[model samples]
Target: MFHGLIPADRYYAYLSFRDIESMPNKENVIIIQTVGAVEQHGPHLPLMTDAAIGLYIVGKTLEQLDHDKSPTIYVLPPQYSGYSVEHTSFCGTISLSASTLTNVLMDIGDSVYRAGFRKLLFFNSHGGQPQVTEIVARDLRKRHSDLMLFSIFAWDLPNIAATLVTPHEFKYGIHAGEIETSLMLVILKEYVKMNLAEKEYPPTLVPDGGLLRIDAGLTYAWMTKDLSQSGVIGDPTEATSDKGEQILASLIASFKKLLLEIDAFNSHV
Candidate 1:
């Protein structure tokens, strides 16, 4: 039941040990692990917003692929906990320490590598844990030179936020804002509470021209409490299910293309 989002045939956890050992083109098979976080996403969204997005994207992408013609791609179980030290002050936020997360990912990568699978992709949906995944990927690469490991954020891959959202939202909606709320509408509509949606942004000390900002070339350490009273950084009121559909489609298409590329990739070249 947990694998309902993914096609049963392509769900990695459903296979037996022997099935894995005997899988064709083991080196070329891409094992995707969806990385997400359980953290406060304001009052309008569920704590599993990031996790839901990651799972839905991966599932939809795989569903669109032609298994007979496409590279062998299997979806691993979602990593639901991630580094969210910044949001720990808020209730419903469950964060893993940087070192603990690093170790957990390293162990997962090691297990995947040991299973004779040479390709692994850490498809993360949370903003706080990209660096952790990247570090684990590099460390695993060093340990196993032949393994092809990739770490990427779901939104960063396509970079569709700029085109779909307003300039202010694109810059400030890093948490449970317009983009995330819109996406959640598509991925987990029942959990979203549109009535409670509100717009809030962190207090900015300097003008837009100044270097100091929440996210930019120059930034400072900040917690959610320091930013907004509602634990929101963007305008969720701007979210619409129509916008969510568009974002979902774009993300699925981009992820499907990326998987094919990774399957045929030759790192040495």
Candidate 2:
């Protein structure tokens, strides 16, 4: 029951102590920890939006893999709360401090390493905490040189945004906008308040020949309040379940490929 969408045998917590001890090739086990956030995703989407998306992606990807032929992969329980200081002004956001998140992830990695696993991957869905995961991954690697640590942002793996959204939405819809809303529509349709969805974008100050931007090559420190009053930074009005489905398919395909590659990867260093 605790396994949720993940296969019962592949859910890390489902394994008994003896079961884990008996597992063969423990060094090759790919332990994925889905990192998400409990934060504001505008009035239209739930606070669990980020967490739900990450879990769904990981769960679906695992489902599609051939257990016997694919690399040994198991998923830890999802980390539902993450660093979300940028959305703290909103009512639903529950943010962990950068240090707190870092320590939590480090502890998880340490436990996994202690349990005889050599590989750990942080599959994060929130836009606010990649830095924290990256820092934790590097620090953990420094501590355990033999541990294989990997981190990835879920949305960064797919290139379907341009096909599903407008050019303007593609660039500014970095938050609870079209991209996320569409995904939510498919992931948690009943929870989505489509009627309440609104289009909003932050002011982009492209000064001195586009030298400055919000989410571009050169960015600034900005909170949701600074750019948008609606707690949204993208056009959710354009989101549709069709687009969400397409996006999910692309993401799953890419994720499956990545997992296989990680299985075969060996560092020369």
Candidate 3:
């Protein structure tokens, strides 16, 4: 086994480092599941923008962690295509039914469990697939009592977002908003066309904004179109690369902290 951190980011050479041999022996190695949809992100952003951004942030976070000896983290290849039925009406959006999305996560979880990495983190970037990941995480936790499963949204780093964004932008945590656009600017600036970015708020009366309760019978709620008119929730025009960097930095810090806590929890188990 490697005596200490490898000072390297790529764990598996052939694949995207999800293989067992490439996995470091470091306790509670995180198997990051990059979940996003092939849905429209408005005129400025590409359909694969969400998945691409998620993968990049996870990879960058792992690289920084390795450099700091924070913890041994591995980046798993992203699920480029996922459940996105709501946006299917749009030209660029590709979606699978909710059930299909759930199965995909379950299968992926089984493989990760078999791979000897007991700790799994579903780092979800797309809102549409939250339930699927949640279902897999909960059930997997029950079936494999020795394993630890968690799902996190990359944009949940409010502290970092606050610093980069104005008070107005922070208030609206909707999709393809200032935060996401800024992130795209950093991750895939070439793909972004700022001039085309437009704001379109969805009708407030839409039931899609209604609450969800998994146990009570509502499994999934809300679609992209339900929230915005132009398929954009917040202001994308305010996006800046500087904001993207800070947001990413905060995400890495949060990931480091969360992993350490999970590792400590697993140590006793």
Q: Compose the digit string of candidate 1's lDDT tens values, residues 31-98.
A: 98889999999999999999999999899988898878988888888889899899999998999999
54-76 in candidate 3: lDDT tens per residue? Answer: 77666665656544665556655
lDDT of 2 at 153: 92
TM-score attained by model 3: 0.80
What are the C-alpha RMSDs, in order, of all predicted structures? 1.3, 1.3, 5.4
**Which lDDT tens digits does candidate 2 get at residues 150-209?**
999987896586887888788788888998999998999999998999988877555545
Model 1: per-residue Cα lDDT at residue 83? 92
- Separate clash counts for every candidate: 0, 0, 1
Best first by lDDT, ranked: 2, 1, 3
State the TM-score for model 2. Answer: 0.97
After superposing candidate 2, which stretches have Cα over 4 Å from the reference?
none
Ranking by TM-score: 2, 1, 3
Per-residue lDDT of 59 in model 2: 90
Model-by-model lDDT, in order? 0.88, 0.89, 0.71
